[model samples]
Target: MSEDIEIAGEPSPPPAVKAKSRARTPTEIRLLARGHTKAALKVLVGLMRNDEATPAVRLSAANAILDRGWGKSAQPIESGEEGLETVHRVERIIVRPEDAVEGDADPKA
Candidate 1:
């Protein structure tokens, strides 16, 4: 979306866009992000190897690189009690932006 700015009493309208943009799928988003993975890893590696970085910051950078390469370690959930039952409750909510706002959404737009 383009932003329109109003200078003083004059209004500046942005150029009209002909094509509409649809939301990208998860795969598409991942592919787009993956394109920057090499650069991201390079930055991480630099941070991890930089002597000027704090030990904690360096450790964090190393961890990020390790996570990308080997994936995160599986975490085990613990009840932290002796023979105690840990019951989890799950709830799902769906929200529509058009319905959430009053008279803000246009079906044609």
Candidate 2:
């Protein structure tokens, strides 16, 4: 036996909506750099080649591409073997103002 269902005056709940999937918006060149350097490089190259790109942006891209191609600015490399014993000799120049000859009337004197 089927039970009878009563449809009250209230309207039935709206149909479940399927969430829409949106394509990720294009990301900024800098932000893209953090995640994928190579991809960011491509974007930079594109920007450099694009005539529509602002002069500043194109210039920046050109600089960035050059930097990437030539490698980032020189970093002070700690040129030493880690966990290995090493000794370095440092020579420092000591200025002795008192050593000036007393009779030598320096212009400043």
Candidate 3:
């Protein structure tokens, strides 16, 4: 139930078109930076090699280089809800020497 009409001897304008912006995926972003990989690594290495830099800064740069070279080490996650600590149950069983032969829990056996 829509109609286009001429007003004041002028035709109506067309609907507005919105510009679409798409985010680059991780792979795409990495590809974009691939060209700068060498320079970036060089900068990191320079930072790592600079004795003037603080020990922590140097270590950070070294870690970054190592991460890129050999991938990052696996990290373990300890998940627990806020205000609560995660706990696990452990079970222990004791068997006497005689129980080993008959597989009985009775001490007499």
Best prediction by lDDT: 1
Tell me which residue pairs clash in candidate 2: none
* lDDT on C-alpha atoms for all candidate structures: 0.87, 0.79, 0.86
TM-score of 1: 0.55
Whole-model lDDT, candidate 3? 0.86
TM, every model? 0.55, 0.35, 0.48
lDDT (10s digit) by residue, model 2, range 1-109: 3345547785767889999987655675557657787788888999999999899999999989888689878765565877665569999987566777778667565
Misplaced by over 4 Å in model 1 are 1-20, 83-109
TM-score of the candidate numbered 2?
Answer: 0.35
Off by over 4 Å in 2: 1-35, 72-109
Residue lDDT tens for model 3, 1-109: 3365556777668889898889999999989899899899999999999999999999999999999889999995666656567679999999757558654575654
Give the candidate order by descending lDDT: 1, 3, 2
Q: Count the clashes in each prediction.
A: 0, 0, 0
